[model samples]
Target chain A: MKQKTLALLTLGIIFGGIFLTMIVGAWTTENTKTPARYTTGSAEGEYNPEDIRGSYTLGEVSTLFDIPTEVLIKAFNLPLDTNPDTFKTKDLESLYSIVAEDIEVGNESVQVFVALYNDLPMVLTDTYLPTQAVELLLSLDRSWSQETIDYLNAHSVIVTISEDSESDKDSALATNESKEPDAESTETNNTTNNSTSTTTSTAQEATTAPKTEPKTEVTTETTTEHKEPLIKGTTTFQQLLDAGIEKAQI
Target chain B: MSKLFKNQPKTLQKKLSIRHYVQFFFFALIGLIAINHTLVETGAGIPFLSDASLHALCPFGGVVTLYNLATLGTFIQKIHMSSSILMILIFILAILVGPVFCSFVCPLGSFQEFLGKIGKTLFKKRYNHFIPQKVHDVLKYLRYVVLILVVYVTAKSGYLMFADIDPYNALFSFWSDEVSVKALIVLGITAILSLFVERPWCKYACPYGALLGLSNKVRIFKIKRVEATCVSCNKCTTVCPMNIDVANKTTVTDLQCISCMACTSEESCPVPETVTLTLEPLNIKKPVSANLNQ
Candidate 1:
């Protein structure tokens, strides 16, 4: 080929390849959607659930809950299947009532989850649900009580709670073993005696007779629990406080 | 006679032209200012013009700055707005003056020219030949594409992309403790390319050169080859730093011509007033003789 002809051919091939690549790129981009990851404690401003992807689709909880699908999606961050306009209007009242009841009872997770389910259209498989739930929980700064922790552990939810606050250190280390039937009554009597001794000690000076009595009561309580090997290993408030400080430094 | 005219032209026995001295003085002044800014411990960083900022002011600066800004938004983001504008204006002036920016103002171009001079002193000639024109022309378009992409990204995402790899920033950054690894890499590449071909970046890679060429076509001051007075020696083209055929055409305003005036110098081409600086209309004169030596 002549040099000019060869140059034109080369240019044609180069441009054609670029055009094809761009078309393929656009097609692929539209088909594949990657779900966004949510993080905790970082949502500093007003909690807009709409900003959280895969939360809610429409206002209707029944059609995903009712109102409009757009409204529900903005408010709750849910995933939905169908168009909001096609949703049955009759289901709106029942879904709204259910959501309201759940919210009043302080079922925040269930309300939010329902909201998300209604709005976002993408199908979140069962495999990814727990991970998403854990992320939502962490972001909301909701602490897990012992019951909640046990439930999550049983369900194999990979949850990581932030380190305990300084003030909660003493209570965290306190051991609560199942009390024996006879031990409960004795414990109540011991608590009454200890309270009375504490009151008297505060009114009197350290050298007075009443001040020494509280020390004896405390010793007596320890001796009763000392008989049990499990109770003997239980940490006191002071010991736990010391351990927390040491741990923080390390 | 040969010993007396070793570095001097046989026709014009002049020590150094006033124009050369003036250019030398201006270069020294700019270099001193750059050094001062680098050394000043005001805890305020070194003040230098970014390519993008330069592009906004002058056609040459604008083209170079635009090209860099398009490719390296992150680097330009750090440049002060005032300095950017000043550099851009300087670039515009350079367009009118035939790449006076590269010869006198552009720190990177000046440094490369200095390096080329050192190479010439050692080797007594150019270390290598120019890249093929076809390949050079194609690669030149890369700067434009890079500029477009960078500008788009910065405009859409509010990012500065070109500031990182601009040679000017790389040179000034060495003094200011603000050298980016990316900028250094680009500078290294430009330097390596320069070793093989004189002013490789200016000839083949500089988008600014392309812009200046446009202004140079209508430039008031231009190198005019008087073919009637010319012997077909090809000496003018041989000594041209930018590799333009200064002896053949009435006007030498090719895109690759940096207006370094090396061809116009007496030592390079021993033709008295053959290639003179004039304000004449372009393409009026015809090619008289072919200088095959070039």
Candidate 2:
């Protein structure tokens, strides 16, 4: 009822509430395993490349996933010499706004940007890239120079296919021979090299091996290895991956 | 023209009152912040200050999220955690200072004050001239109704219904696609009405103001009139934007008092120690001492 009493009471409520929230917040933050939302940096520790979100900057992502920062910047058409970690999806949103408004700026499709920069399964929709991203990508002018194509190849899709014909299986096995004897238990350096090369180079390297004397047969096999399953209607890049296509092959 | 005006002390003299500076400071601060947000969105950005935009800085968003959290057990996704913290800070300030945020910090309030200045010049003697006292007394209660509706719909729908109609959001987000047509219309009407009525939206429609106004009844520090020194001069009553009857009341218990301090100023009151804002000390039998002033 008295003014002093009321003032003290009000002060008590404020200090008390603030203390409670701080204590709770400190404890919750200590226990939290997930990265804080809306921030980007490597000092926060690494996360799964597959699980990477739009809020992360290119530099943070480059360090975590070990993707080449230059390749990614080029793929996204970012201004040269940008600190990858310094820019995030929020910045990209800024770029999008400029492209829409300012005549001085040029436009790029966000779908193309995401697809080429993030080699993992982000922006996917089961069989393909996300539908909205796909729609945007359709109108984009993707100037895939041969080198850019190689970078994309190295970061390409997973192999979930099991329905290959017996002969197709034979060729897939043949490509694994260049892998070192010890690490062949899972995949090896050979597959990475094969996966990173152009389609013709991979085929040429596969055929020229001394163990394979059947050159014409190997050429036909390589064509079937790539072209046959891919031409199927509705088969997306992801589906090609599901059918055992590598980045180099796709 | 009167002896009272001549007797007004020079201590509170100002080309611009504290409230005017506060209004000017906040209006400029918020405008610059809004521009920063837009520039960041457009990629001509500098990595400094805060990356969170104008909407994140609004405390009212936090208030709505708190209501949604209490009633629906889920926080609105669009409302940031920073907003919730800001809401708590505002509540703290209200309890201590009796809704000074309405008079000083809230950009919308400052905007209304700016328009009110233009109205004062254009209408001269007819400034704040549209509404009668009787009609205004009844209409001022409508903000409470709006408060309830905003909380209810936002909780029930699990979405921010208030953002669809909030004029502050409209002002900051006018160029963005997120700006609601209804909100823009409300903003237009509020700006126009500001010319005829002081703080039209704050008095009659702002749910956040309705919530903060409650602090006037129970806030710790308050503007109090010293009856021993008080004259029957009604100068304090004329200066109050919220129209509290400052001369008639010993303690400003009116819910509409925004703690702007115009009434307590020496220029407005014409006497020192007549009006003060402080916690009432325990049964004092003598005049205020030097230690008490500290």
Candidate 3:
């Protein structure tokens, strides 16, 4: 109980616990046949984002997809010297969350990788990219604006030009309609989650523009058998589960 | 309520403990809402209210960041701005008082304290049971070890190594998919132990608590004993959740002192001015009794 004795005992426990966990972890790794959450084995299944956790390293994702290392770094806005193998996906998410919070976005919740995976611009409209682009993405698009998006999708072209050149063309061809997104349509946007929205925003704009087609094909995730009616993205998982979605599909 | 207050003024302590209830309610509600993903998937929404990503203003984040920066020469994550700012805020508060966050604000700490009350009710006089005094003393320092390990492993590896093992994160995130067996086991064990020991996680496991404990040693304001009006009554020590020897020490320099102010409360320490919280340095004595008399 003496302070000196206590201090020595404390140190013993501290070092002992550290040594124990380290040894045990190593031993477990050697003995156990458990697979890593992320590994290069596309034969197993397609890359599903749901399986992604904070433990998955950025290097793993890059390797899995054969994505350029610099592109991944640019997407996440990581330091140049940062070891991709050592840096986890959550690190990028954490950084994005901080920036998101700075912009008065939610607490650490923004999935920045979704943007990278979907091939949207690193940053959305009206925000600085966390880090400067180190390489060029071989895509062809004017600006992210609606008119340019419509024209590009009308031609079904890509964003292949340099950003400066594209932006110059965009200024010349861009429709400067500053109208707010209608709350009814914008607010009702449940199907286009972050990934889906960023990916389909251009195509959707092209089809929706010109107001020529009164009979627009509304792609919905509804079922005819359900009498009470179920909105696809809006229903809580719990409510869905209660409604027997768990028995069928989640 | 009026009749009860008039009959038992001492019960002011119980009434004042409403802050715990508020903290408890806030956490429980958030925990529930976080798990329920209806609002998030339901469609167009303001991103601020619905957060699905792991981590939300946990100060433990800053400790891991410090470790990563020190060990790896880079942040564990690219952006730790929120956590860095949060750590700065908490440390500043730690310097001003002791670990007031643990006692007043931390939902996890509050949850454990509430569980500790259940332990007290079950054990009665034997409620404050611990291991052998020497072993207990040693065991109490394990949190510091956890603190170091969490930082080192997180920094060395590319992940928040403590995430799966963190009881606080586990408890709040049970409804979330992040709940691992390790966290559940630790949380279950700690929840069980809380009935037998007060603030078991804070005293012997939490890395954040270990960091904040330093505030007791160097904080400007301290809980001091005025030996001039000396009384050896052990009421303060008995009430101290961290179990510091409050009565014996002339000034409580124990890093375990959480500044709950229970020792300085009127209900504790029968003699007024015997144990007082003072801003003056322990080296320079103050006229605490005169201030009390006035």
Candidate 4:
């Protein structure tokens, strides 16, 4: 090919490909905003914890993770009147900017909190959670592993609110003292998880306080019972039928 | 005294080559897009204009994120599907006709060439000749090392590590807050060096250029010299920006060839079709020796 022909062809291919992708809706120049979901294993279809970003709003988090908005507001000690819809997770940085040194709380702290609340596995980094979040998690009726309790205990940062004349408060750090989380005292989190799954009103009531009474047997999909069978590779239809599904269902 | 008209009719200014137009088009397009991106971020951009970030438009982002995409099924933050598409298209172009993207599309290469004009005027013949041939030869391979290191680090960290030192981003998105100080410094150094060396960054530090340079060895259409009708005035070699000896080589399989065609018959060669970029290898017959029977 002539040099001129080659040059024009190069431009055509590049710009043409871009144009084609644009037409086909594949040419995205920004992130999808929605976090990536797990594509394989037991967590398939569940949103990946690591894919969360600082741009996510508290309301968006509540919707995506099935976590209550009130619970998130309480966990982070956000202002009662603050709308979760407009509250960006990244705002936590400036909100806690005046906190004591060596212990920082930010978006990663939210990721940690969400992961622990939903019992989703997440890669633990040097992320420190706010003490309120840790306490909120402990107060719920959920069974946490000893290792997780230890992790929460070690990584919690106590943020104290100091209101100014304008009523704008900074989540200030009071002290660096490490306090043990009371995980065993709460029997309501697991019971709440069951009741919350049953009705919207019960879920709202469960978020009000940690119920002390022993609850009915929980039937909601716990982390351990959520795995579904996946047919893969050379698994035949005959084998699938024998395993139990009817031909009509298949 | 009427107007002095003793000199011969002025020659027509040399026509801007197709390659120059292409280069300028991309350079301007990217510049506008980058600026528009900043404007859009502030909620004050032209509604019809695109506001894609430099990383999204850059094919090098696709190259660096290949490992991450393969293992994690996601591009590095800030890079999007457009980069991957451009990367694939450029790869296809490279396999067909060598690294035309470097010469015809990359704004950075065009920017360096623009600076080189000043270098040519100031230094004359001494321009692009300061480096010793042996040292130049060794330094050219450094880009490959850079390519490997960038890919490894980006893969390991699941982030675009190259952005920290990418002079291309620094040049195009200098006004943006995303431009790193190290990248700005590298761009400054490149700009200064362009006054001495031709494509200093492409020859030494551009990881993407290093990746595309490999295409020269196996490109379907190559820069081939017809030795049969060649008047070896060495004009082709002299015009080669990469300092390749195009006059001597029957075929330019050099890794540094950017398919700029500066050394081709259509551009610098005095003899038509002598130094041509063609798909066919030239068929020049060997001369019979007169004293073979002795």
What residue runs in model 3 are displaced by over 4 Å at the alpha carbon? A1-250, B1-13, B18-22, B25-54, B67-79, B282-294
TM-score of 4: 0.70
Preferred candidate (DockQ higher): 1 or 4: 4
True contacts kept of 2: 0.00
> lDDT of all the models against the reference?
0.41, 0.56, 0.51, 0.73
Pairwise TM-score winner, candidates 2 and 4: 4
Q: Quote model 3's TM-score.
A: 0.50
Instruction: Please give the DockQ score of every candidate, comma-separated.
Output: 0.02, 0.03, 0.02, 0.35
Docking quality class, candidate 2: incorrect
Residue A170 of model 3 has an lDDT of: 29
Over 4 Å off, model 2: A1-250, B1-14, B68-74, B281-294
- Residues B109-149 of candidate 4 have per-residue lDDT tens digits of 99999888767766767889999889999999999999899
Top DockQ hit: 4
**Candidate 4 segments whose C-alpha is farther than 4 A from its true place:** A38-45, A54-58, A68-113, A126-250, B1-15, B281-294
Error of 3 at B87 (Å): 0.7
- Evaluation by DockQ, superior candidate among 2 and 4: 4
What lDDT score goes with residue A107 in model 2?
A: 14
What is candidate 1's lDDT per residue for A1-250, written digit by digit as tens? 1223322332343335434545665211110111122222222221322222212223233332333444332222222232443232222222221211111111223333442333221111111112234334334433333332222222212111113312322222122254334332233223211000000011111121132121111101111212111101123445434434343432
At residue A227, give the lDDT of candidate 4. 23
**What lDDT does model 2 reach?**
0.56
Clashing pairs in 2: A59-A84, A59-A85, A94-B41
Using all chains and alpha carbons, the TM-scores for the candidates as numbered come to 0.44, 0.53, 0.50, 0.70
